[model samples]
Target: MKVVVAGSSGLIGTALVAALRRDGHEVTRLVRRPANARDEFRWDPARADLDERALRGADAVVNLCGAGIGRRRWNGSYKQELRDSRIVPTDVLASAAAAAGVRTLVNASGVHYYGGDSGDRIVTETSPAGTGFLAGLCRDWEAAAQPAADAGVRTILLRSAVVLARHGGMLGMLYPLYFLGLGGRLGSGRQYVPWISLDDEVGAILFALTDDALSGPVNMVGPAPVTNAEFTRALGRALHRPTPLMVPAFALRVTVGEFADEGILHGPRAIPTALEDAGYSFRHPTIGAALAATVGRS
Candidate 1:
């Protein structure tokens, strides 16, 4: 299959591109800079500019465009940046895919679509949209891809979890701290931490690209659910370090502001119901296995 990928420089995007190529799929990458490689094409999502050839004759277009949610303290400006960075590029790509008559449009979203602090309630693809800023952002982000679905193209909204990787992502920020024996739980450590391994994250995208039975919102997360405290312990165990510290909820608010609450202190108990129903298997089904593959390698 011929696949065109946007946001090809991100953590998930990088893995997805390599996986697609390794699996014998022809891949074209959309870059913001000038195109230099045969498989590269330049596109400007902010200006809604994409070369006519970018999506031509493509079987699928996978959009992973979004600013890092936890990259900065949440100010009014940064929040707007998060929305623009995701919704704009998604709108452009979805429109282009529709115009080019692409067969599939796999757009990126987040498990936060179900809102923060889902408590013990299990979230599925059929769950309704939740409240809060992140949920609204994800809701809008997924809505931006409506053009493709309306045009009769099979569109898949990938509501991804916090991706655990060896080098970069959530683990990247925590690896050093955990290795130094300073890792600890945030807040009361009772919030659910929706997470997935980098391998399965990439594998799920590939699976969604070809599985005709899958469409709409699919939760790309681990089958097993773990609380933040459980995650902290698992990560500590994986690194062979003692996690004896705790970051209070007030301190977290003072440190990272609003993100400390929504991004860290709260998360959904999201499960991969759609993926499992579609017969997609996970490489790291448990959090312990996921941390071993990621933190153990590091």
Candidate 2:
């Protein structure tokens, strides 16, 4: 199938593009600059400019384009930036894909859509959206794809969790601390950290594109959920370090304000119900195994 992926330079996008190419699928990347002679195309979501002709023959369009949530603080301006960065690009892409008559549109959402503080309850795709900057952004982000949906395209809304890998994303921020023996549980150490390996995340995206039964919201997370303390322990074990310190939630708030309180230090248990129901298997189901595989400490 011919697939066009936005945010092709991101961690997930890089992995997905490589996997898709390895499988002999024709992949096109959407860039911000003008289209070059290469396989890359151009689209400026802020200006609502896109090369619709490049997407004319696309069988599937995966919109992974978005600003990094963990890259900065959630200030008033940054908050708007975060929201617009995801929604605007989605709106532009969806409109183009719908007009081009694309068959499948897979848009990215976050696990925060289910809210940050989930206590112990399990969340599935059918659950109602939570309230917060991220949840609101995700709600609006997914809603931007309505044009494709109305065009009878199979749209998959991926509610991805913290994607665990070695080089980029969340791991890069935590690896230094873990390697320094300062990594440990956040806050009271009881909050759930719903996570998925990088491989599983890419695989799930491919699976969703091929599976016709999948549409709407799908949680891209591991089967087994781990508490904050458990994740700290597992990561420490993976690095063979003594986790002797705990970053209290109050300290985190004092340091990074609401962002640390909401996005970084807190999360709920999100299970991939739709993926499992679609008969997709997970390579790293548990946190310990995932950490081992990621750090090459096995």
Candidate 3:
């Protein structure tokens, strides 16, 4: 199969490309920069310009293009950037795929679609989207892919969780803190965190592309859901360090500003219902295993 992946420089995108190559699939990276000798294609979602011919013969198109939520404070401009970064590219990709008659389009989404707070109420594919800026952003992101779906393309919205990888994503931000033995629970430490290993994240994306039965939203998370406190403790244990400190909610808010309140310090429990029912196996379902993998520990 020939696959075109947007956001090819991102953590998940890079991993997904390698995995696809290993499985004997020809991969094309949708890059913003100039193309090199490798399978690189040009695209600028903000400008509504892309190499449509590059997508012509592709079997699957994975849209991982988006601004990083954790990259900066959730100010008004950043929020707009986040929304634009996701929706515009997705719209372009969907339109191009529809025109090219692509078979499958796996659009990346976040668990934020489930709302910021679900309490003990477990979320599924049918769960209502929460009312917030992030939720609204996710809603539009998924909606932007309507053209591909309308074209009879198998469109899968990957609602992923906090991806745990050594090189990037959440793990990259937490590694130095953990290594310094300053790691602790965020906020009140009771929020349920839905997380997935880097390996499983890549696996799930591939599964979505291949599985004809899967469409709509699929939670790309691990089977195990842990509290913020438990996550901190597990990660500390994995690193053989003490997890006695707790960062106050107010302190986080003061340090990171609004993002500390809405994003970093708050999250809900989430599980991958579609993956489990479909018998997809996970390499690191638990936080301990995830931390071990992040630190190169068994």
Worst 10 residues of 2 by lDDT: 259-268
Top model by TM-score, which number?
1
How far off is model 2, as Cα RMSD? 1.1
Q: Single out the weakest 10-residue window by summed lDDT for candidate 1.
A: 289-298
Q: lDDT for each of the candidates?
A: 0.93, 0.88, 0.86
Q: What are the clashing pairs of model 1?
A: none
Candidate order (lDDT): 1, 2, 3
TM-score of each predicted structure versus truth: 0.98, 0.97, 0.97
Compare candidates 2 and 3 on TM-score and give the better one.
2
| lDDT string, candidate 1, 1-298, tens digits | 9999999999999999999989999999999998999999999998999987889999999999988999988899999999999999999998899999899999999999999856789999999888889999999999999999999999999999999997898899999999999999989999999999999999999999989999999999999999999999999999989999999999999988988878889899999999999999999999999999887745
Q: Write the per-residue lDDT of candidate 2 for residues 182-218, one digit (tens) a residue.
A: 8988899988888999999999999999999999889
Please identify model 3 stretches exceeding 4 Å from their true place: 296-298
RMSD (Å) of each candidate, 1 decimal: 1.1, 1.1, 1.2
- Residue 6 miss distance in model 2 (angstroms): 0.4
